[model samples]
Target: MSAPDVVFVTGNANKLKEVKMILASESSKINLINEPLDLEEIQDVDLQSIALAKCKQASKLLGPGRPVFVEDTALCFDSFNGLPGAYIKWFVKSMGLAGIVQMLSGFENKGAEAITTLTYTDGEGHFHTFQGVTHGTIVTSRGPTDFGWDSIFQPDESHGQTYAEMDKAAKNAISHRGRAFAEFKAFIATEFK
Candidate 1:
C-alpha cells in the first residue's frame, strides 16, 4: 500500500527533523510532508488552546480534505508557577542559559516541566490535540545550551543528561515532544492508515 500524505506545518527545521524521525517508524503507513507556515502563535497560558488555534489556522490554509498537523512546546518552571509557561520561546530568546540559572539560583526547589502539545486534523474540521510533559528539575548547566533550556532541564527519566546533552534518538526516548509524538504516531497508524 502507498503511504498516505499528511501536511506538517512548522518553520523550525529542528522540529521537522524530530517529527520526521518519530514518524519514520510508521512511514510505511504515513507519508509526512513539511509545510512551513508562520501562524500567529498565541501566548496564552493554556497550551492546548494555543496548539488548537495553530492547528485550526494551518488547517484552514490547507482547506478541506487535507490532513494537517502542528505542535507547540513550552518549558515551565515550578519556581515561577509555570510563568512564561507557554512563552518559553520568547523567554529563551531574552534570557540565555546563564540568565536562567541565575534566576533560579536562590531557589532551593528547582522543579520544572517540559510540555509539548501536538494538534492534528484530517481537515475534517475536528482538530485533536495530544500533550506530553516531562517532569524534571531546573539544574545548573550540565551540557551545551544550544537549544532553549535544554542544558538546564534534566529529565528524571533521562538519567542525568539534559536534553541538549543527549543525541536525537536518546533525547527523543524521553522527551515531552517525543512522548506526544508517540501518541500521534499511534493515532495516525490507526486513523489515517
Candidate 2:
C-alpha cells in the first residue's frame, strides 16, 4: 500500500518545516503536500472556528475527494483573559515581541497558553478538529527573534528556554503543534488507512 496524500494549506515556511519535522519523527506514511492558499480568514475569537473555516475554504478550492487540513495557532495570556487567543498574529504584527513583553510587564501573572487547532476536511464537508495547548509564561526575549512570539513565550516544560532557543527536535517534542499533529497523525492512521 502506498502512503496517503494530504494537502496542508499554509504559506508559512516555518510552519511547514515544523509540521514536516513532527510528521517525519513519527515516521508518518502520509504524503503531506503544501498548498499555499490566500484564503480569507474569518474574524473570530475561537481558534477552531477559524481553522474550520480555512479548511472549508481550502476544500472548496481543492474540489471534491481531496483530503486537506488547515491550522490556526494562538497565544492566550492568563492575565489578559485570553485577549489575544485568536489574534496573536495581529498582536505580534502590531506590538512586536518587545511590545508584547512590555504589555505584560505590569502583570505579575505572565502565564499563557500556546494553542494549535488543526482542522481537516475530506472535501465533502466533513470536518474534524484536533487541538493542542502548551502552558507557559511570557518573558523577555531570549532566543531567535525571527518567529512570531517565540522569543518571549517559554513553555512550562522547558527549562527556562523559549521556543526559538530550543533546537528543532526539542521544541517539536513538546510544542502545541507537535501535540496537535500527534492527534492528527492518529486520525490519519485510522481514517485514511
Candidate 3:
C-alpha cells in the first residue's frame, strides 16, 4: 500500500516547512500536499472555530470525500487578555515584531502563550481538531527575523533561546506547531492506515 495523500491548505511557506520537518522526523507515512487557498476565515477569538471553518471551506472547494486540513496559530499575551489570539497575523503585519513587543512594554507581565490548532476534515462530515499550546514570554527579537513571531517569543522549555535560534529538530520538538502535529500524526496513523 502507498502512503495516503492529505491536502494541507495553507499559503505560509514557513508553516509548511515546519510541518514537513515534523512529519519527516517521525517518518510519517502520510503524503502531505499543499493547496494554498485564499479561503475566508471567520473572525473569532476561538482558535478551533477559525481553523474548523477554514477546513470546512477547503473540503467544499476540493469536492467530496477528500481529506483536507487547515492550521491556525495564535500568540496570546497574558496582559492583553489574548487581544491578538487569532489575529496575530494582522498584528504582526500592521505593527511588526518590535511594535508587538512594545505593546507589552508597559505591562509587568510579559507572559504569553503560543497556540496552534489543526482542524481536519475526512470529507465524510466528520471533523477532528487538535490543539497545542506553549507557555512563553515576549522579549526583544533575537535570532533570525525571517519567520513569523519566532524571534520574539521564547518557549519556557528552552533555556533562553527563541524559536528561530533553535535548530529545526530542537524547535520542532518543543514548538506549538510540533506539538499539534504530534496529535495529528497519531490520528493519521490510525485513521489513514
Candidate 4:
C-alpha cells in the first residue's frame, strides 16, 4: 500500500505547527502537506460551524482528490455563562487574557472547558467531523507553562494548577488537540487503509 495524499489547510502558524507535530508520527505512510488557506474568521459563533466552514473553503480551493483538514477551537468559561465560547479570538484581542481573568474574578464559578472541532474534508468534498473537549476550571491567576488561555484555565480539580503550570509535553499529552488527533489517526487507520 502507498501513503495517502492529504493537505492541512490552516492560516494559524501556531496551530499549523502544532498539528503537523502531532501528525508527524504518520510520516511513514502519509504525505502531509501544509498549505496556508486564506479564510476569513467569522465573528461570534460556535467553533464547530466555523471549522466546517473553513473546511468547505479549503475544499473549494483544492478542488477534488485530496483531503484537507481544518480546526477551530474556543475556550468557554462557566463563570460567564460561555459568553466567550465562540468569541474567544475577539475577546483575546480586545480584552487580552489578563482582562478576561479580571472579568471573571469574584465569581464563585470558575469552571471552564476547551472545545475543539476538527473538520476533515476529502478532495471530493466529503467531510468527517470530530470533536474533543477537556473539562477544566478557571484560576484566579496565571500559571507559568502554557499559552493562550492555559495560564488561567485549570483542568477540573487539577491540583490547583492551570495548564500553563504544566510543561508543554505534559499539557499537549491531554489537550483538546491531542484528543482530536488521536481520533483522527484512528479513523484514518481504520477507514482509509
TM-score result, candidate 4: 0.88
Instruction: Give the whole-model CA lDDT for all candidates, comma-separated.
Output: 0.86, 0.90, 0.91, 0.77
Write model 4 residue lDDT over 14-123, tens digit each, in one string: 77777777777877667888888788766655777788888888888888777888887888887777778867777778987778887777887777778878989877
Instruction: Give the number of the best model, judged by lDDT.
Output: 3
Pick by TM-score: 2 or 3, better one: 3
> Who wins the TM-score comparison?
3
Consecutive 10-residue window with the lowest summed lDDT within model 1: 140-149
Query: What's model 1's TM-score?
Result: 0.94
CA deviation > 4 Å runs, candidate 4: 140-146
Name the regions of candidate 2 deviating beyond 4 angstroms: 25-28
Instruction: After the best TM-score superposition of candidate 3, give how far the Cα of residue 178 lies from its true spot, in angstroms.
Output: 0.6
lDDT of 3 by residue, 1-193 (tens): 8777789999999888888888884455777889999999899998999999999999999999888999999999999998799899999999999999999989999999999999999889999999999999999999999999999999999999999899889988898998999999888878865
TM-scores of all models?
0.94, 0.96, 0.97, 0.88
Arrange candidates by lDDT, descending.
3, 2, 1, 4
Question: For residues 67-159, what per-residue lDDT tens digits would candidate 1 score against the true structure?
Answer: 898999988888899976888787778987778777888888788989999999988787878998999988778877666778888999887
Evaluated against the true structure, the overall lDDT of model 3 is: 0.91
